[model samples]
Target: MITVSAPPPPPPPQPQPPAGHAAAPEPARGRRWPTVVTSLVLLALLMFAQSFRFPNDSAVTEPMVASGDASAAVDAGSFTVKVDEVRFAKAIGDGAEDSGLSDFAPETEYIEANGVWVVVFMEVTATEKQLTTFESRLDSGDENVYASTSWLYNTFGSVDDGFPPGIPIKGAAAFEVPEKALKDPVVQMTISSGPGQRLAGEAHVKLGLSGDELKKAIDGAEETLDVPAPEMQKV
Candidate 1:
């Protein structure tokens, strides 16, 4: 009986799974945000290496009339002027160390003194030689030399002909005066003797308040030139 039972048991201890084959693999971990953050940092570094350097200096200077406190001037009375256009010219004088303003030129010159706005145009003339030199000299990096605006406590007037009187002519025109005019108001303009060099001619138009009439009109008003455009028309 024992022999028979042993024989049956020995038939087969069911094959046990080979060593580790039956063990399940551990659960895998998911992706983390640190990996994503690392990728973004790398991308940012690449983009930062790409950006413009600014220029060191500016050659042209803006005109003065455009600079001053327009608010104050507008507040004064009936202060209205419209500058439609402007002109310039260049000129040179013989044996002169500098052409002064003779090199500056303008194309048209006229003054429009209508309601609420005043515009002035003056002819300009400049020779070829003068212009060449002016161009070379205008290449400045300073605010003092080629500055565009000047102030006079009193009044500025043009002594030229063909100008009308009582038309509020007692004031300066905020026009562009070339380098020549900057040196001295009383300067000489001459012709140039060079190939392809032609005579320079032009006019300058300026805009500003008719200091004479505007000042007089404003003195009477409680709030003079300071009046706005809509209110100025009423005056």
Candidate 2:
């Protein structure tokens, strides 16, 4: 019977928003799809800019010269070349048996069965007036590379000695390679603009031997080959 009436039901709990505000409209549920799509587009563009930064061996941008017929003339950029002959021997003489070299030795001071000597006889003719040099190497079928021999001295003219324009010179390059590589070998000749400029205006010459031909050459008896003096002729 106190008749307080519960304090008029607490004034009906009036709304609490300030004077002129609409309560921020429930924070707008924010689309979210536009932001996610923009982030993915930016990531795709970044990956597209990184593809062309380096060289790949699988791409061949330059032309390669193919192997030519035996003793056939092939045209290089600065010169014309022909592989005249190839010989395999157990030992290479110091050219002493033929001439003034007699005071040196009868045979190479050493011999080994695990390896053999390869002599490449080539003729080169300069096509231009520029000073040019020649280099040679042997590539086995398995892609092993062997440089020409520096130990076995030869009286034959050196390709390193550059040639003059329109002049032809004949010489031999010797390589000491594993006996097993004697079969199906390819000889590569590189002509350069100068002794120091090995790649400038470079040209390549490739020569290969048939399987039967290489076997016969390797099975031959030991013999002494005289390094033929360089012969120069006008083109």
The residue-by-residue lDDT of candidate 2 on 161-234, one tens digit each, is 66677787877777778877655677676665644443333334455665776667777836555554456765
Candidate 1, poorest ten consecutive residues by summed lDDT: 226-235
RMSD value for candidate 2 = 12.8
Error (Å) of candidate 2 at residue 112 is 6.7
| Deviation of model 2 at 106, angstroms | 9.9
Top lDDT prediction, candidate number: 2
* List of clashing residue pairs for candidate 2: none
User: What is the per-residue lDDT of model 1 for residues 1-235, given as tens digits with 9 covering 90 to 100?
Assistant: 4554444445667777667754524221234566778889987876665422223322122111211122221111111222222222121111111237535633222222111111122221221112211110111112222322222111122221121211222222232333322221111111122222233221112123334543443233221111011111111
Q: What value of lDDT does candidate 1 attain over all alpha carbons? A: 0.24
